[model samples]
Target: METKTKKTLLPVQGKILWDVIILSILSVLCFLLPFAHYTYHRVQWTVSGLQFITGTSVQDGEVVIASQWLLIAFIAAAVLSIVFALVFPKIKKIRLAGFLIILGGILELLFSVLFTMQVQYIMADARNAGTSYAAWLLALIAVITIARGFHILYKNKVLSPLDFMIMPGCIYFLINNYFPLVGIFIAFKRVDYSVGIMNSEWVGFSNFTYLFSSSDAWVMTRNTILYNVAFIILGNLLGIIVGIFLSEVFSKKLQKLYQTTILLPQLISIIIVAYIVFAFLSNEAGLINKGILGEGNEINFYNTKIYWPFILTFVNLWKGLGYNSIIYLSAIVSIDKSLYEAAYVDGANRWQQITRITVPLLKPSIITLVTMSIGRIFYSDFGLFYQVPMDSGALYSVTQTIDTYVYRSLLQLNNIAMASAASAYQSVVGFVVVLVANGIVRKIDNENAMF
Candidate 1:
């Protein structure tokens, strides 16, 4: 029985060993394949990975040296992977072998990305210099090697079933959330499509100066921050009121109907909502203009700037109220009914019970939502500011926010670097605001603060 078990295990171990050796060899071979394709002064050419490592001269007399450190690191990782695979199993360090393989795969993958970026930077002036399929194939092999390493770890009991279950989500989060963070570098670059984004010249704070130097900066900043402030205060206040009202309703059917009716607007597309606002506020053939004010007495709501602040505030509140109320209502439902009953027995009226019992207990939820809102105070609802106003130039004074300004700049100038700078500014400021707000909350009530 022991001999049969040993024989069966030998094939499995041999298969894993062979897989690592083959992948390491293939990674080394990939360096001999075409790594980049380029066109210089209307002449096309391809450069192999080995040429990139050894350094090459382009048509324009530019000496292109893709990072020597990265090339050396990649070669070292591949060589070490083969050596470890052979030696570790002999020493019975199988788990250490798996870790080394994982490290090697990560180094190869990092080398692929960094090397391509470096190549693009060096060949920036080329008409269309780009990474070839060999680089991507190397990256794919690196990914496979990583998966195999993880499998070995699992077999050795280094990883749990739950780790495998969460692996997909972790990978998705890295690709979707963390990977795009690299674009933050664009804010500091003067982007040139011919040279690609990574190769663009650095301009320090020049991109940011476009926002601060302009007179419109203060107006847009005011509009964005004030509107968000109103939205946070009034949205939460009304949501709590409606949530409490809904909780008190005796009829379940009527409550559901009310809930559905209110949430309908939240579900409506922003474009449709904009049109709905236009239908009511339009100067010609509008419900308000024709039915109430008459034809000649029409108020040019879109052209007039004074009414917009209130109009926008109302529209935003109306549209978002249902969704906000549902959140508070869910929190309200989870409250102990015994508290409200006890308050009633203590001779507290309905209003007093709400103020003394319901609202106080809802503190944690309110604090959480408010902290989250503060984190986005620098951002604005672009549609609410732009589309609802019908893009009337007359209302630019009141309607302009950071988002709309960046959008208009993008449309008119097509300055992606400037747009990226504006976004980075908002993100950084919003992050600071959230930290400040949470710190204040923590000072006031440590338990309720969102850490």
Candidate 2:
């Protein structure tokens, strides 16, 4: 007997919403249509023959670069958005359209700046390239409308709603985090505030040379990486142990008390913690010297460099242990009880159950936490290294970190450009390190990887 085969049908994909279509059409129109024209206005005479959209103008009978690149960027972005809307129509594709539109807006801004800067050069026979307020308005509208369309897709459930909630935060980061990237220009320039930021002389990497040429480079770099490595390894190990122990406690009241006691340190301000450390380690009035070691045998703990590595490590673990363990404890609590019951049925002891089942189950969490920690391996806790050690010059060998070094240099030199250069270096290295770490995690176990 021949059996008839059943044909399986895939779920139909949702169509791109009307809002996205309307905004995309508008964006394309803004790019293609004659939205604005460049003109020259000096004193009383006026010249208005430059067309921005077509990138053409008869200025002083000579062909000039009339914002051609800016127009190309806008047209390219608009074409890309239309292609995505029609061909793919996925939420991710719509989001990409929004990103392209933002880029186009940025290009419009650059065009205005460049044209303003070249207004004098374009002056031949009293004709100069001038910016049009309409171009800026059209670019602004395109960006806002595209972003609104992306939001509408999320609201209609064509995209995840969670993304819509974080839109405000994304905007904040774009403004705060990414907008500061313009300062990188200051890093490369010999910033003379006397002649505004844009008019500053370009020095071409001279600012960065001082950082490498510094005598304390190796010491600071070594201390930062080594201390962070120790913290990451020890922090994860102790956090896991404490978390497991906390989870195993039978009384809920006792668990709460233990959790509260450990967590209190995390809430305390670092400055207060610094003072508290000072109170304990002060030579004349220290609790350690007068109360424990006796007044005659007092040690100037602030000036002592040798003991700070161990001291800082201990303090870091103590302050952060409770907070870090809470994450592990949450994962532990969510685990299935039946597995433990089955382990008990097989006559497995508590230690055996932990070793065999609990630890194995916690692997993903541990891996995830460890991967994140490694990303910050190039960074050091500034307060722990600086304030906790009292920033004593004697302790520089042991306590100096990238942040502290930058802070110290900034204070002593008061050179904004140099400080900016250091910051740019740190940001670049940190970014590369994070990417490398995430890549490594993805290679090992794709399931537990952050990306």
Best by TM-score: 1
- Model 2 ranges off by over 4 Å: 1-143, 159-161, 438-446
| lDDT tens readout by residue for model 2, 140-241 | 665665555565455446667677688789879977988778568777887786755566888888988977788667787788889989998999999899
- TM-score per model over all chains: 0.79, 0.72
**Candidate 2: residue 44 lDDT (0-100):** 32
- Tens-digit lDDT track of model 1 for 1-451: 9899767667767877898889989998998898888987678788888887776777756455534777778878887887877775574545766787787887778777887777667767766878788888889999999988898888989889998899899889977877667679889999999867756799999988977898778898899999999999999999999999999988999999999999999999889999999999988768899899997799988888999999999999999999999999999999999998888899999999989988998999999998999999999999999989988999999999999988987787798888888878888898899999999999999998888
Model 1, runs deviating above 4 Å: 1-29, 36-46, 57-133, 145-177, 193-196
Residue 119 accuracy (lDDT) in model 2: 37
What lDDT would candidate 1 get against the real structure? 0.86
- How good is model 1 by TM-score? 0.79
- Predicted model with the maximum lDDT: 1
